[model samples]
Target chain A: MTVQLQRSATVAGPVRRVRRSKHRPIWEEQPTIAGYVGKTVALTLIVLAVLYPLYTIVLTSISTQATINAAGGLVTVPGEITFAAYRQILSGGIVTRATLVSIGITAVGTLLSTTVSVLCAYGLSRPNSFAHRPILFLLLATMFFGAGMIPTYLLVSHLGLIDSYWALILPTAVSAFNVLIVRNFFMGIDQAITDAARIDGAGEWRVLGQIVLPMSKAVTAVVALFYGVGYWNAFFNAMLYINDNSKWPLQLVLRSYVLQGVTLPGSGVGQVDVASGAVTGLPVKMAVVVMAIVPVLIVYPFVQRHFTKGVIFGAIKG
Target chain B: MSKQVADAAPARPAGTAQRGTADGGPGGRRRRPVTGTAHRRTSASVPVRKVSMWAQIKRDRSLLLMTVPVIVLLAVFAYVPMAGNIIAWQDYSPYVGIVDSPFVAWDNFERVFTNPLFLNAVKNTLLITAFQLVFFFPIPIALALLLNSVITPAIRTTIQSIVYLPHFFSWVIVVTVFQQIFGGASQLHRILAGHGVHFDLMTDPDTFLILITSQAVWKDAGWGIIIFLAALSTVDPALYEAAVVDGASRRRRTWHVTLPALRPVIILLLILRLGDALTVGFEQLILQRGAVGPGAAEVIDTYVYYQGVIAGDWSFAAAAGLVKGVVSMLLVLGANKLAHVFGEAGVYQRA
Candidate 1:
């Protein structure tokens, strides 16, 4: 009976593959001409809806002042493109300073948070460890409940974290959610491997550093990307805690310049200068927006492949 | 809502639970399982003995050391602020601080419930949330189904990547993009004006609800499709073959097979969404609140920020925030209970 079952299981694999390759599934029948047209139009419209605004933003950012004036707003067609906007923003102005601040925050914050998260996750994954259950419960409890904005702000103030970089990096650091994801990934590692290492007289540190972390690069990268993007994109914390405009991160600068249309004094494109046609503020604003987004865009493709795996493993089975 | 569900479901220690059985008891005793030849040899000669909790803790010092910073960080950041929520009961002043603030039992809550602006914020939040639930919920599912029907994997992946790009963008970028396209000074506005027509959907109070909901959909719908596509990939192709062999039509097969396969995930997401119905995009709304005015834009979260942080009504805002938090918790628990009735592992297993 076992032999028969094995033979059938072996047979079924190829049979399924052959059926899938040789014939179209009945549910996926060839559509009628009109149906095909409808689907094509629907998909194209969806794609355009997502892409057109982004296209316009890029175009407007690169277009010359004359082109922007001719277009009367955001330029669509790329005519007489110039790198003036990019140059203006990157020329040691408020935008450049803010970009540096954002980079520092994202880099430092992601590293610190990822390290803390991995350590905690590793410790918590060992359920047999002392006080593991209570610690896990304590961490998980933060997931559901939070002190309101007032109290949290009060706490930050009381701790004298106001106007400090530590306020941004610390209060929001060690996301319980990310820790849980990392812990889940650590737990999914084969027990026998760790057991073997322990038997070899490897300390928990050696086992974690040498064995577990090497195996968890994918999830670790994904978690770090999550934290990195979060730190990169955060503006509300700066708005709340940092009273000094000079300490503002890129996202906060983007918010003020693009959304609120506020041009800083030291920025090359001052409001009066822009109004007097030295430069149209639109291109500069778009440049700042692009600057805020480019880092994530550059990193996203490398991390995109891991998103489905990370999200599924972190989310569904949790 | 997806975030809320993801946050609600704590990782189950399934491996530890399995190991618990082998270890004999769940007491605070540390069992050094026979892992290597040396350990096994040592254990065979030496009998097991009960170790005190302190000794067990000492034995696990390295692990405990690893955990100390995390515990301290969470204590300082999370637990302390949670303790600070007591300001809801006290007439909190930044000058007097938490300890010295005069106790004004339930007065803040009374003001929160009775305030007209607060009521308006609640109404607007619920309205936007309802719109999102009705219009934005099915988009990702529909998109996933559409993408699934494509025969070419390359085309599907390209489309998926393009759609998922917006999810990474900051709300600031998203709002700017929307404003650039639909604001009063936009190209669309110029074109309409050239033709003797004027329209500004971005700041239009009458249609602000639609505007924000569309922003949410455009920002997140592609990312939402990821979970659905993951669910779709798990559906057995053989089931489709079986239905085809039984002479099922395309629509009928979808009804019989695909819908049922997707039902659990859909219901799970829906329940999670319902739990977060009160929290309708604070940052997005706050950014635009200046344009459309508070009457059109205030939500519970923004209300808390405006009242507490900006206006110095600390106790009142805390009271409102406390209510929002409690209601949200109750909503999640109630939804999880309902999921249990349907035999789904909603967030956590019943204890």
Candidate 2:
């Protein structure tokens, strides 16, 4: 009877395999020609919706002044491409300064935010740890409620964080949602390994540093990406706190120059004097726009694979 | 609202390792996840001991210390700010401060509710959110279904990477991209002008609703699809096989077996969206509010900013913000209740 059951299980596996079409199950009907064409068209439009504007803007940024004028607006096709916009902006100006500022914030904020959140998550991971439930409540409560903008601004002001770079980082640093997700992951870890380490004379700190974290690299990386992206793309915080123009991050720079009708930095000349992030040329403005997009384009791919990995998806299951 | 975008990674090594151990271990009621070191496997082998809370605290001092920074941050930045909401009742003054500011009770609330500008802002915020709810919400679900049909893993992943790329983009970039393409002197405009036709899009208040909604779809709809796709991938194929064996057609199986699998995720997203009803693109609106004029663009967020931060009407702005926060909280709570009635988990669970 055991032999017969084992033989049937082996047969069932192959039978299931026989019905698949590479990525799809054979049970689903084959898509119609019309449906396939419709799908392709729809997908192409969606891809183009994101890519085309970006393509044109990036193209315009690099295109020579003559090419820009010939195109009469944003350049779709490249002509005598030059890195003049890049050269002018990156040389030494508010644009350059803002770029440095943003990089610093993204780097520092990601480190601080990731470390704090990971520590918090690990601290709460142990089932029945001291005050774990109440601590978890204290963190999760912030997710449901926020101090309105007025109060938050006032707090920042009173703390003398207004116009300070720390204001952007500190006020919104601890993402409670992140804490919850990481905590869930930590709790999901087997307790036996930690207990073994504990018996072998490893303390909680040593065990976390040596064992739990090495196993948690995936979630930690993903959490860091979230904070890094948050800091890099942060505009509203800068808008609210930093009235000092010199301390402006890239998003605010992009906003004031590009979107709000291009008052411009130091407008004119083939070699534009880009003081305080002003620019008359569309290429320079588009260059700044490219600056805002490049980091996300670079970093998101590495983090992208983790979406299917399920450490994060498990938290969503909650 | 928060950048809690689709974070669906599979289990880490520790989790799978734990699951392996669970499968090999004893099968009994003790297998359940009861808290405390008391019932843990290692403790079982070592002989469990009943420990006091103070002893537990002393033993777990390092772990507790690790959580202090976050707890302190929440207290100072989050909880303290909520406490500061009281200034809404007072005629708040920078010179006098909160302690000395004269209290006026509902007068600030009355002024904010009565102001036509604030009313217009509320009207515009609701109108935009409702329009996007109808038009923009389903695009991601459709996209997920569409992407799911591709019989190639490489192609599906590539499409996903390209599509969700826009979620990371700042509002500045999103608006700039739209403006360069659809603005009055834009690519579309240039093409139309060559035919001697005139139509304005970006800066036009008349078409502002369509413009911003398109931006919303472009920027967020792709990111929003992540949760749905994750849900789709989790649907058991056995259910479909059973449906097929029951004489259900492909269409019926998709409608019955596949779509229902997505019901919880859809309901959760809907609850979250409803909770954010008062907050329709604060950064996006503020960036473009000047172009379309406040008549068509102001939201409660910008109203609060303009009133409190810009105009120095701290009391009035604080009241407006308080009203928005209260209403948003109620909306989330109410929607979660509604979700519970439908047998969905909604966003969070009481249990």
Per-residue lDDT of candidate 1, residues A1-318 (tens digit)? 346445544545365523232223433445566766787898899889889988888888898878888887888888989988899889997889999999999999999999999998998888577778888889877877776678889889888988898888988897888888889989999999998987776777888999999999889998999999889988898899999988999988888877887767756443535453423577888888889889999999999888888877887767
Please give the lDDT score at residue A238 for candidate 2: 99
Candidate 2 residue runs with Cα over 4 Å from true position: A1-21, A267-280, A310-315, B1-50, B194-196
Q: What is the TM-score of chain B in candidate 2?
A: 0.84
Residue A264, candidate 2: how far off, in angstroms?
Answer: 3.3
TM-score of chain B of each: 0.84, 0.84
